[model samples]
Target chain A: MADEVKLFRTWSSPFALRIVWALKLKGIEFETIFEDLANKSSLLLQNNPVHKKVPVLVHNGKSVCESFVILEYIDETWTNGLPLLPKDPYERAEARFWAKFSDEKLWLSARGILFGVETEQAEARLQAIQNLQYLEEQLKGRKFFAGETIGFLDLAVGWMANLLSVLEEITGYVLIEEVKFPLLWKWMQDFSDVPVINESWPSRDKLVIKFQTMRDSYLAGKI
Target chain B: MADEVKLFRTWSSPFALRIVWALKLKGIEFETIFEDLANKSSLLLQNNPVHKKVPVLVHNGKSVCESFVILEYIDETWTNGLPLLPKDPYERAEARFWAKFSDEKLWLSARGILFGVETEQAEARLQAIQNLQYLEEQLKGRKFFAGETIGFLDLAVGWMANLLSVLEEITGYVLIEEVKFPLLWKWMQDFSDVPVINESWPSRDKLVIKFQTMRDSYLAGKI
Candidate 1:
């Protein structure tokens, strides 16, 4: 009823959940429309014609696509909420660099280990470890990538909290070890402890089931 | 002297030039240290250890890497000049979307045509045209991507002004035509017509010489 916020998303999509966490953190209530990734809804297609992907936040009829962009929009619109970005321009740029880094370098490496062939998986595992180490260094002196608060960068990379464990279980590749990534490991725990995120996040069981199916399909050459 | 801004860049780099234009548009005077790509300066390596690439803006001893991030940093830091981003949240998101689109989709396609093998070049040419058409539709009635004034999106896609011609010269693949992309053609001219851009831009003959060498190297398997 308030601002007619509608989120076009898929339940299992970590990208879409980023928007969900942002919206909840802002204390803005929105109706969620779950989408089938295989057959995207016309509304999603019409709203986000370019990517045809989920997590299109349609607020008062206008659509904002891309999870990070959507998060920025939500932060700007609801100025009263806990701020997602820093007030300082340089700090904001630093936050942005890390968020882009998380997406550009981190996610792909994790995906490779999860779905790649044997040799590829081994290479990807090393890449993932190196990326995690960088994240560990970034998180060393701070509670979150954005400092003591849960901010934009944390939410952007928060999927690893649950997904990493599920991936480890499925692939038997223990990437994010506590000893190796103490800061990142603590950051993961701190990120999941957020009430809204914990509430909105898909259960580990849900992710495990879906990922297992995906892995089986990939191994069988069906996907 | 004022906050000590230094830019690490190369003369021929489009990415580095983006920072140059941003700094110019803001009227923020800075010294440029040209770096040879083959033998990158230790300062460049130290500043942007992740990418080890050009166009790192160091202000007051702090480094901000990535062209778009630097642009945003400049816009936010200096509020006196023509604002690069729109005031409204939605408009800003739209601008960001297109900027990302131009980088993710358009750049790859242009690279494909410029340096990719024959088969890859043909496929990439089609992709580039389709992307340009989408951009043309976006520029339908507006004078600029950010309405009447040149902004981030314009700067993001400004390479077509100089580089596209050189690419066409080298590959003999003409992707942007006046007949098909009247709006974009006009936009390109308007972008290049900017006093700051025109004044600071590298000569077309210079780009031709550079790209000719690059194309030859690619064909000879020397790259």
Candidate 2:
């Protein structure tokens, strides 16, 4: 098709990294344009006028916004590659369900613990632990959330492997501890072992400094 | 492989209607179980342990939660009748982008106007109007959001046709007026004329009564 694939992304964005991992896993070559979210570029604005967020995958001049939507687009377009989702309709639906859960519940609950006010932080910690417990039960006897090998569900939840540790450093609130969620804790370890993911994940120290400053500003009411 | 199709839905839920319309559009026969959300059935709790919400499409045995996800699943599972999404990748992404916007932005904005407190209602009205303006622009040259047919984006935004009018009667605010959003006003008329949609849509009078009571409860701080 000769489509010039380009990705508009920002550093330290877990959403953007999901696309990066998807493209890498599918062996697609794409040009990455780092956008300054503080002062968003004209390209990002034109591509995603609605959200004005990053991780816009531009293929042949058309852009696909939203992380999970982009992953579906990639998988569909590059049908020749290792399938991101399972072939069975039921299994595919389950994978989509978990991917959405990872976005709506897992990410939001974790955010509450990291930067929420005092009461919010307490409630969020309880909810986060509850969500993780459910996930741990689902992960029983499975190597990954997707099972057997890394795929859509694995990529969707993979942010937990890196971001959870970074948040622990920034907020001193430990999650994925072996005592509470042994299965998910092990799953995180197995998720990171994949070469593409291990090589491309952001540095923990860098993320810590960034999130620490962000949390401080949030508490100070500067942002 | 004769697969049995079943849908767990609530009569008053616009979300569940989306799945209903989707199945009817594809000519797929299914059984509907009306759920009492106040006292949820064990089937709903067991199938959708996470959200416990309705519009869970159970095909054969597995259930798919989330209305938009269920629509995609139905489209993929039954590849007959009419296609929900366009075949082109870019067009499909655009369809998904709008479908998500209908959820994240439009629904919340409309809710803000309908049920928000004094100050919130004013702000929500402005946001809701602005969102309608954007959609109006998108619909300037198109009969439907998905072009000539009632497809994914149409189902996603169909709530505006029924719910918007109900909210207007409850709150005395008129949206999608011909003067303000001419294209959307016309699109609303065009959308309802579709035999499948018109036949299955809930009666406006009944919905008005339901929402009026609900809004009173909300304003009285009883909800």
Candidate 3:
């Protein structure tokens, strides 16, 4: 294809995985440039000077950085592809609200385990689960965030479900449970069962080892 | 017009101004519903149950909450207008980067006055100025956030500039000075000078009094 699209990514990064999932769902063929986190490429640095982070998508040599923004770009560019954003403006805004909230609250909660060392830090992890009660509240009756279809908000909130168990195992605390957060528990199943998402996802066995390894290295001060 | 739009806003809110500016730029006619913060309507609560915040854009009986999300909705629905998002995906991503950063760091710094007492708040104000240094560094050779034309990022970041001066005036610490943050200061002036923005902006004098009054009320435990 003359319309060459290239993606730069580092494995074991949920932020990077967001873009990867979108690309796979869209079924867009492109070159994948797996970046060395330790020794970052000049192209990655040049393309994304502000963040200089992974999952920079380059289409025809023009780059789109930031996973959420990149997701929006890919959705906008490929008209005939699977629509990532909702068609209704209000629904789109609601999806974005959850997206922003995901960045604001959920992901940060997951990061708690990565840096949790103190008693307060460990307690903070529990408090984060309490903070995520809002998700259960939001999911009360909606089949999906945008109603009966997986959309951007679903993808975003789904990241929490994928990471929570691994995060709990690493941090030595059980947070989300089917017995407690039934709606969110069901959300985990609903999201993971999406065929496209299922195909695109790294195996849980694979992620558990990867995340656990990274967490161990980080905790041991070897990272 | 059967396809109607309504904006519920507070007089002293930067978030509200964003919607006002967007509608004015698009030449869209809509009913302005100014809500008294002291006496919020049931409709406002019903429309935005999550945050219950103003600056909600009600279009054709559908409600869109959050200013940035509203901006996106506005852009998508009304196409025969000056665009807020850059046409190019890369540029749009860059715009989003700055926009998100503005919301995170800049707003955190600007809203310092809301938290602590005087001296602490002054540094909180200073932190906002320091936050702009990174922005200044980025704008070293550029005119606007995404290059020549004012785009989405410009609107978000410019909100910081408007509020910075207001916060400074109320807190007795000037944040933006011509000599220190020249680029940001000049850019703010350039931004407000534009006919659409200039016409739509609330008067500075009015905001200064309103901010000071609000601050005093908070300190007096009247809030």
Error of 2 at A6 (Å): 1.3
Off by over 4 Å in 3: A34-43, A109-149, A170-187, A194-196, A199-223, B35-41, B111-150, B167-186, B209-223
Candidate 3 interface RMS: 1.6
| Candidate 3 lDDT, A9-37, residue by residue in tens | 87666777777778777888888888887
Candidate 1, residue B208: CA error in Å? Answer: 2.5
| Pairs with backbone N, CA or C atoms under 3 Å apart (clashes), candidate 1 | none
By lDDT, highest first, what's the ranking? 1, 2, 3
- B1-223, model 2: which lDDT tens digit per residue? 8878899988779999999999999999999999989999999999899999998989888889999889989988998889999898777887888888889888999888878867888899998898888788778679999898888999999888878988998888888899888899999999989988888778888898988887778879944
Best by DockQ: 1
- Encode model 1's per-residue lDDT on A1-223: one tens digit a residue: 5699999999899999888888888889899999998999899999999889988999999999988889889989999988999899999998888889889888999989888878999999998888887788888789998898889988899899999999999999998778888998888888888898799878779899999888888878944
Write model 1 residue lDDT over B138-223, tens digit each, in one string.
89889889899889988888887888888998888887789989998898898889998888788889899998888788879944
Residue A57 displacement in candidate 2 (angstroms): 1.1
Better-scoring candidate (DockQ), 2 or 3: 2
What are the DockQ scores of the candidates, in order?
0.89, 0.81, 0.59
Which candidate number has the best TM-score?
Answer: 1
Per-model TM against the reference: 0.96, 0.95, 0.77
Chain B, candidate 1: TM-score: 0.95
